[model samples]
Target: MTQARLRVYILSLFLIATGIAVSTFSAFSLAPLTFQVMGVYWLFSLLYYHLRINSRRGSTSVEYGINYNVSLILFTGPFGLYLFEAVYRLIGYLYKKKTKTDEPGEGVQTFYNVGSFVIQGTAAYYVYQWLIPWFEGNLVAFWVLLFLLVTVTAVVSDLFLLGVFSLLGDIRTRADVAAFLKERSILDMAKTAFSNGLLLLFLEQRNWTAIIGLFVLNYLVSQSYLVKAQSAQDKHERNKYEHMAYTDFLTGLHNRAYMELKMKELEKTKEAIGIVVADIDKFKSINDTYNHSVGDRVIQHFAAALKAKAGTDDILARSGGEEFTMFLRGRSFESCLALVEELRQQIESDAVEAEFQDQTSRIPYTASFGLYFFTEQEEVPIEKGYIYADQLLLESKQLGRNRITVSPGQQHESSLSTS
Candidate 1:
């Protein structure tokens, strides 16, 4: 399934599961309410994902944290946080959609930003203490004060180290987060800071349950983002490898494998295909006389030339050493020859002077082409087309080797067979 479909399905399952868990917890006591805060955060995250899909330019990974903050606030008293978020999005739809997309986050995400959690966590602690029928007033107030100090201090230290580490290039985006925050990497520094601070805060207030729950929640939260980042990194690496496999490293042109794939596609289409086979004329002579280094320069120069000459629909590839091929989309044989000839003349008249290996030299070079055209129903086999083009290349070689040779295929036979 597509990533989008999979994401939607997973989110749907999470929402259902969290809903059931919250309902069960609600039946026994208020313990599930804290997790419900997390659930609400997830719901907002889902909404943000949809919003991002609708606005490509404005999508940001940081939106997830923004949703978490809003969800925490909603649980405090204003019960319609989700509805409020929906209305806010509608009001600023155009504005938010115009924002630029960026990597997950930059620098510590701000002290004020994380400070909101302190406020919410303090409120949650007081509410929990007050809910007990036999709870005394002094105990409840002390617990509230204790939660404020520990949660605030722990989170502050995490953000402080996060800011410092970011300057040292230890920060990570969601797409590449695993490197810095492995099983016990630099990322743990932030977690360790938070844990120590929380220990002090809860110890002061003696709220053991809140301490345990907060620690567990923080672990879950960080790991969720880390896992997501690891998956994205894996995907990016796979795509990079696949691209390297099919691309010419030096010239950045499609390589032989891509050419084979194109041929397969053309076979399926049964459409007319134009092939221009190119060889760097006297390429080995240049390599011997001027050294292989300058010879590489000539190859790159001509590759750039071929790339520029190709039309928008053309596929230009480095088929082999000192050889190239261009498949021009829906073109007649004569025009393909004309283009190849134009490229020849362009290189013949062009002089490329460069300083290489501490020696300045003017390298003059030229190329030859053997053109072939085949409609889908041609009697000639695909491999034979290559042979025919090679023969024409020999003809170009005979005629001083710097021009285009139209194919020797019989037009009537081609028409009869393809028709």
Candidate 2:
């Protein structure tokens, strides 16, 4: 059976067993007046259930303590709690279906939720019954003991059920489970559990002032959790947008826009910067011969080779189609020339496979390089440096591609080198 169907079957059996236990053991001491009061409160609970606060780990939602409150008061025993929860969840499922198709599916999620409530209620009700008699006259001690016992039992039961479901579901790996737990803040659950415990105690005392204060406090807590969730979501979106803005989707390198910004920033530093502009020698021919997909693979392969050769602090970017630019900060002009020559040799040595008509061919590629160096002391603008480098790049192609050409502007110190 599928996980959902298995869960449904198990939950049906558990509910049936709990129902039998409740019917058999309970005194059912409450009058018709209590039942009537519970029915009215169930309506309030339905609204509260809809106004759920999501757990920080984002694994699930809680009804801002209202579910536990109903379990504590309306249901005097486990059987009553189970029956009330069953009805509550059934109506909730129906209401959700009528409103949105985006909600989690009805089977496993509902089964797990209702099953957890049953377990928590069963354990808590029996424990409270066993302990209440021990401190009957000392109301403060009774409330304190009840709060600690019920909260611990209920929260533990809920977490145990959640762990079981996670193990059985998509979050089975240890890393995924850890991340899931981290996302669903255990502390958040503890806070909610503790707050609900206090609320239940206040309600039992029937102190209207304390009850109202507790409700307000719980509402603020829930709101604070939601606000933090929203803030995190906003930060995630901002980071996503920034990455897209600066990254090249095709090669996963920094794009030209980012490189331009870097260039401007580096200009202010007044450090000597070596610029190496490289272009694939026959990229258009490759794309035309092997198709664009294989061409893309070649581009990715080339990018990998470039990244392998670059230093940790080196700035490399895809300036445009089949073209890339590298800036070597604080490197001499000769070092930059040697770096470009190394890249040329690397590209020529590496071979990529391209498949065509059920036949695969190993293709070796080469790129032409144009090198220039500039510093803040130089009166020449960087734009003019790029233009001069492009002129030498054209000369390299004219002299036969797969070679490096350096500009002669700095030839007073050292002559232009070709590789």
Winning candidate number (lDDT): 2
TM-score of every candidate relative to the true structure: 0.51, 0.73
Index of the highest-TM-score prediction: 2
lDDT tens string, model 2, 63-165?
3344454334324555555656667778878777887743555545566566667666666666666776786779577556655555655565546545655
The Cα local distance difference test for each model comes to: 0.56, 0.67
Ten-residue region with minimum lDDT total, candidate 2: 410-419
Enumerate residue pairs that collide in model 2. 57-183, 57-184, 57-185
RMSD after Cα superposition, model 2: 5.3
